[model samples]
Target: MDVLNPEQFRALGYRAIDMIAQQLADLADGPTRRPVPLDVRHSLEDQPIPETGADPFDLLDRVQNEVLAYPMGNPSPRFFAWVNSTPTPIGILGDLFAAAMSPSAAGGDQAATYVERAALTWVKDMLGFPQEAQGLFVSGGSKANLTCLAVMRHVMSEGKVRADGMASIDAPMIVYTSAHGHSCIEKAISALGIGSKNLRIIPVDSQHRMDVEKLREAIAADRAAGLHPVCVAASAGTTNTGAIDQLDVIADLCEAENMWFHIDGAYGGFGILAEQTEGMYKGMNRADSIAVDPHKWLYIPVECGCAIVRHAEAMRATFSLVPAYLQEDRAEPWFSEYGLQQTRGFRALKVWLSIQHYGLDGYRKMITQDINTAYELRRKLFARSDYEVVTAGPLSVTCFRYVPAGVPEEQLDDLQRQIVAWTNASARAFITTTMIDGKTVVRACHVNFRTTSADLDVLLDTLTEAGQLVLQGAQQA
Candidate 1:
């Protein structure tokens, strides 16, 4: 029997939509407020599975009251914690429609397959990448990095790694990346059986960009040691400081070395849209592969990333394994042939809808606004003698610390962390801390289109209040 009649389903759906709309309207107020009481939270934790069927409406009520009422504060304009972006309204609706359609994006001449192709084309066009490049919408940056690096492994092995496994390679394949590179690169190396030890962590200069001279030295040293240099994974924008590596220089090195060049642009690739980053991403289009996250910059809902490879056939050969039962005679290659996942979700719908909702020019303006606001925070921090600017934008991330005159040198790092905790607990705004050059500092990333200078002010105010309380408590202790 049907769980609910069509008319009943329509009514329930409307109710659910209304609930979501209301939540969105109220999202800005107390964006980080802890709504649930401690007792109620304990009760929720102690919940037991129901032994019997419950009314659908009752379940919906629980979802609205218990779950939706509490949020992670990512939607708030003042949420300057990580790289998370507030989801666009159009993207949100696209997610709902995609789920309803429920098409496995594995390939075949289907609607979702075409939508995904078009979406990937849009991504390439938007990023100034070649339209001929092959791409796949993945879960997030982690999978995107893994997929591209896998192709690098296979290609560097001359396709023998796929058939004969890692044992086929005689020399140890070495991968080089900056110490500030995302941890996912090392994880991908380890996962591909390349061994993390073979991954060289090149040091960065004062600006946090990968030092080109040091990289060249490392490659030469590896060659002298009889290790095979496979690839160099450079960061378009590092997560901790938004520092972009010297891409054009790195590209030149990779070309001279005859190595695969991969750019991890997952967090700040889209920063290219900002006018201030005019020449920052130079030679990025020449990379053998690039990983990017539309969810971070395009305001798409979570779980959307793209891996674009210059050589489509090479990527296909790395993951294309058509079983006898799954074989299909289609002119267009299936998405399953592109990466690790066979049964992929229709992640492109939300991304496609979001890109269309805001054209490239629109995205550029919004992204520029975010970068400007981040710089504003940096300027404010610089104006105060007590606050020291650790790492400030060339993009939309700023890391700084409050160092009041008499604060103990040893306790500075601990004080910075305590300020974050106090401010977050107050629910006025949400921020985080990160280590830079062995010192803990407050970090903020501006990716939300809804965020403005006002939100930045709120963040500073909250931090100031939190800092005072932390210092007072420290003195008492």
Candidate 2:
């Protein structure tokens, strides 16, 4: 017998829908638990680790009361700690439908074909890539980058790669990335059996963007030693600073060096949807491959990412392994031939539904609002003498540090740590600490669609208050 009867399933669905709707509609008043409550979190492990099944009603109730009530934090209006991990109505419903439908998208002619094709085309075009671009739905940015780079390795070796292994290549092929680039590049290189030594970490300019000259020089030196610079990764937006690398400059360099250019636009690719910053991603069309997170920017739930290739042939060359069962007679083979997925989810459904429900105009307005709020925070941050902004932000992410006059830049860590700790403990807002230029600094990324000026104000106010308390305690001691 089914553990969840028809009636029980209906009730469970309604209950979950209501809980999510209420959370979104009343997000302004929602208490984002910044510092996770250790005591009330006892029920988190109340369930049996490997229970075969459970009563649907009881499970739903427990989830509503225990899990939802005390989540560490969700990206909503009150959340500004990390980049937007917000949820959209259409996307949530689309995820539900996807689970219910269970359409396997691994080039199956019967399941998830049209929607996946549309989603792939949309992403390809949206990033100035060609409509013929092919890719696969992956876990997220890191996985997406790994998959693309793996293909880069395979292609650079000219399809003799997996057959002959890394030793097949004559010279030591190096993959170069900027110091400010996403850490995923390094991880990808390591995962692909390309030693970390092959993954060169190039330096960045003052703005944290990758230095083109350094890249050229590095490639030249590698060439002098007969080292093949097979691939170069450019960042659309870095995770720590949200700074976009100069794609145009890097693209030119890659062309001159005859290297495969991959752009990691997991965070900043969505900016292409916004009108004002649309041109910033101009040179992405020339890239051999690009990775972007539909989950992060499209406001879908987690674990949806794509890696699009400029030429569908390149993708096929990278990953087409004809399985006896999946083999179909075709000149080019199926979409499954590209990248590292055999049976993929209907991940495209959530993103496609969200985009259709809210047109480009709606997304543009939302992005504009987010950008405006960031600038507002910048103004407020600079108003006080104790605070200083590290740089003018190009996107919603603002990197600033709590700096007190006459204090050594090195000691700012102690004070910044206290401020972040207090703000998180207060349950008003949350942020993360990062070391910028060898000095500890605070990072506030504004990506939530529901966030407003008032929430950001609470974060700033709480920061100053925390600083004051720390200073007072220091005086007393």
Candidate 3:
């Protein structure tokens, strides 16, 4: 049966739009509200599934009150918990239009396919990748990394992996990444049939950049032991500390060793647009494949990531599966031939519309502002005697610890974690913690486009208040 008549559908749609607009307008004060109570959440969870459809307007009311009342806090300007960003308004609209169109983006010469190609071309242009390179839009960093590494496995196998699998390779296929690299690399390796034991964890330097000397030594040792070095997955920006590995140096080593060079630039690749990171991402364009997430820094909505590869045919060799019913005589290649997905969503429209709304220069200015904000955060922490800037690098993340003068070193880790809890509970600011160099530290990632220096001030003031309260309890204990 039909869900609703045209008039009723329009009414419901308008109401939903109005609700979303109101929420967007109120996001500036989102962090002030405490999270939804557990009882409220459990009540929603305990509801039985309805066999019959309910009234659409009633459901909309429940959604507006129950769901929209509680947000994940990322859209709030005071949120510095992780790499999540506030989506652009234009991008949100694009998502709505895309959903309305509802085109299957897997294959064929459809309008959705062309739009994806155009968006991918813009992504390549932004990253300085060659126009001739092949790319695709994936879910996010994890899938982007997996798609690229799957191609790496195929190419490194010399056309044997697709037919015979990992068993065709004689020597163990080894991959290398820094200790500070994203954990997705190891998971990708394991999922690709390369054992985790074959993944070498190279050491990092004082700045948390990958140690080139240690990497070279590891490669040499692997060669000496008759193992094949397939690829080196370098981090453009690590998660915990935002440290950028030496891309140019690692590129040179990969060239000398004839290994596939993959870059997990999902978190901070867009940092290349900022002048502060001018020389950091020098050789990124030279990578065999690179994974980047527009959702993180480009301010696009969630589930928009790009996988770029210099060798298009290698990717086709890895995942091109065509059935007789889906075959068509078209000049353009289908997106399904490039990666693991067969029923891909139209994720490219949001990226395209967002980038169009904010041109490259506009993006550059925003990213530079974010970096400057991060610097201001460090400057404030540096000026204070109670907090120590622990391991923030040259990006938009700052890892710091609350260390009162007389507090014991053993108690500092727990104290920092407690401060995070207290600050979050205060409903004034939201921050997170991470382990850096075996010490617990508060991690603040500035990917929110709405955040400003004033927000940083609020964050510090709330953190200071939280630290005092937590410190009093620790002292008494």
CA displacement after TM-score superposition, residue 355 of candidate 1 (Å) = 0.8
Clashes of each: 0, 2, 0
- Give the poorly placed runs of model 1, Cα more than 4 Å off: 33-46
lDDT by residue (325-425, candidate 2, tens digit) is: 66563443566778677777888888788878877777777766776777888998989788989865577778888877776765678889888888777
Worst 10 residues of 1 by lDDT: 26-35
What is candidate 1's lDDT per residue for 284-312, written digit by digit as tens? Answer: 99899999999888888998989999999
lDDT of 3 by residue, 59-172 (tens): 998898778777777778888887888889899998998898888798677878888888988888888899888999999999999999999999999879899988999999
If scored against the real structure, what TM-score would every candidate get? 0.97, 0.95, 0.98
lDDT of 1: 0.89
